[model samples]
Target: MSKDRPAPGDRIKPKKSALVQFTATTLQLEAFVVAFAAVALYGLRDSLYEKGPLELSDPNVIWVVGGVLVVALLVLSRLTAKPVGLAGGTVAQVLVIATGLALPMMYLVAAVFVAMWVAALRLGTRVDRERREYDAAHPETAPNV
Candidate 1:
């Protein structure tokens, strides 16, 4: 085995990643926002844009797509605790912005959420690094997990 590899008898403890927790929380909140946006979209469909964006003349489409997004977001939030979950979060950002195609004003809303997502990723990573350093510096304070 290579020098960095641990022997078969060695066991490494696993700790929860702060980044994953932060990201998952962000996603859960975003799902809530999207759900409300869908309701507002249904109400304003006739008053704004004439429901012609992408030939979507039926308001029911709004409910269907919105419901799908809400469910997808919640599921993504649960998955975000896993290693591959970040990729789903990235794809979710794209999907959120794409909703702008159906409603022009949503572009602005999507931009705000996108900004939040970026912040979570960056800030969470920083917090995780700092947490690791703190634990390393003061092992006595570390949890006995």
Candidate 2:
């Protein structure tokens, strides 16, 4: 079969809700971070409390978990670099938050909460930056432009 292509003005468009998509993706990122923090905190709390303060030689579980999370976050950030991803990410963030709260922990709950906040803020900033860049590149398709 022969292939067809769009003319110069026939720019392909996205159909999904950029905001919703972004929000969902962001939620996923947040969830992953929260879960990671839970594990990390649970693993490190003893050291933090027993010793004077945190040290490099501590459990290091957080580093391991955080490293994995960083990869996932980076991938999501790249994939959902568009407005749609931001919307989806937000939704995902909510789900993550809810799940995080439901889980059990001795004192890890507090650390998880803090991590969630940091993840949300950081992810929001990244999404915002991506949206700006996307808007600049595709002025016509940019949301609320």
Candidate 3:
């Protein structure tokens, strides 16, 4: 046997799966919802730019700004380990709602995303609770492995 290996009588413990690790926290799920919302906003760029009521020198400005917001939210998602990330998400949601100033249609989109974000936070919390309970019940089993 390899020197690093445990003795014959030692118990082998399973490791958590990658998916479980990735979604282990409520922040992660909230970040995911925010990121999804960002992408959805980006997808509407062309339409918003062309038909949006905002009178800008160039319609492309909308696309550029929206794209930046999307990228920022995506980055925030990965930074949810810190409290600031959640704050950033809240700010992002406000910005999304503010998009209505440029494109009235965005009000509806933003509302939908906000609903989704709230749902993610609530559901993620429940899932996390369940995971903790499961781990408590099965001390020897790797959580969500």
Best lDDT goes to which candidate? Answer: 1
CA RMSD, predictions in order: 8.0, 11.0, 6.9
Q: Candidate 3 residues 1-145, lDDT tens each? A: 6766565566656543332333234334434544554455456555534545654345366457756776776776666446576577667778877766665666887787677666655665577677677778856443333
Clashing pairs in 3: none
lDDT of 2 by residue, 64-125 (tens): 54455455444555556565554544444444433333233423544454465456556656
Off by over 4 Å in 2: 1-14, 49-145
- Please give the lDDT score for candidate 3: 0.58
Q: How well does model 1 score by local distance difference test?
A: 0.79
Preferred candidate (lDDT higher): 1 or 2: 1
Number of residue pairs clashing in candidate 2, backbone atoms closer than 3 angstroms, sequence gap of 3 or more or interchain: 30
Return whichever of 1 and 3 wins on lDDT: 1
Greater-TM-score candidate between 1 and 2: 1
